[model samples]
Target: MEIKVNDIAVDISGRKVFSNVSFEMKKGEMVAITGPSGCGKTTLLNCLGMIKTVDYGKIMINGKNVTKYKDKEKTKFWHDYATFIYQDYGIIEDASVAYNVTLDKYKMNSDKVQKILKKVGLEGRNNELAIVLSGGEKQRIGIARAIFKNATVIYADEPTASLDVKNRELVIELLRQCAKKGAIVVLATHDERLVNECDRIIDMNQF
Candidate 1:
């Protein structure tokens, strides 16, 4: 799928977060949005994820103008096509890893959940509570969730910010695997190491 953002501008609370930003993200491509803090990288990711609407310009996903989609349609499309991993590692503290992996989807049975956990090297941690896991383990669970969603586009914000070297690599490798399976992996990150491995870099500073 191809994602095209044309002359996109966004303002929150009357403050300009992004202005006239435009880019095309093709499938199977890894794009890194990098800049210093407060450069609106996360805002751009939110816009791309449809968490925030642009004040001006158009957002086209896979050649369709998503601006035309109704709320229900947009929500369904978002659930099916895009998944985001937030900077804080969004996880349900009270849920077991298996539940987290299934995300309350009945079709995602225990067998599939266990398989995904193993795929993420967290097979034994399925029964563990989210809060008990290490930072890296939490991040892994986040990735597993995205995978479970079968998303075509994955947006990750500073995905490896709090991990040790080994876990950091694991996250990076998982992202690579996602891309290999034909998802558009867009990352908002300041890590030079992660940026270096990206297929393309959208340097927000240039805007």
Candidate 2:
């Protein structure tokens, strides 16, 4: 789906963040949102994922206004269309990798989960618990979760921030794989290497 953020203005706790921000993202396009810390890059992403409400704006997805969705309707919209990868790798620590990847998809089989785990270079680790995995492995589990969902858009917030060089490259490549498969990939990041590799860049400071 194509995403358009029109004349958006946002404030958090009486502090102005983004103002009159607007952008258009095409399907299969990988766009990077870059700015200094606290510049509202993540906030813009949250708004895109419908995780945060903008004080004023219209979010159009495939020509439909999603900004006005009711709370329950917004939940449904997020379930099927978008996936957000947080920087901290929000995997369930006690759950096995397989369980974390499958999430709420009860019908998904072990084979499918294992296959995607392998795709993210986490083969044979599905039986391992999330807390036992290294920082990189946990990030891989997050990638596997998004892939299994086959989401239309992936909104990632500082996905490579906490990793070392090698793991950072791994995460960037995984996101590129998502874009190659025709998903709109939007990343809020400070990593120059990642920004250089993306298909487009959105400078949130323009807001």
**TM-score to true structure, per model:** 0.94, 0.95
Q: Give per-model CA RMSD.
A: 1.5, 1.4
Off by over 4 Å in 1: 105-109
lDDT per residue (tens digit) for residues 1-207 in model 2: 898989998998899998988889998889999999999998888888878888997999999888888899888877888788888998899988888888854734567787898899988887777899888888878888889889879988888888988888998899999998999999999999999989989897787
Per-model C-alpha lDDT, please? 0.86, 0.87
Question: lDDT (0-100) at residue 144 of candidate 2?
Answer: 85
**Residue-wise C-alpha lDDT for candidate 1, range 1-207, written one tens digit per residue:** 899989988778888776878889888888999999998999899888777777888889978888666788778987778888878888888988877777784644567788888898998787778889888998998899888877799999999998999999999999988988999999999999999889999888776
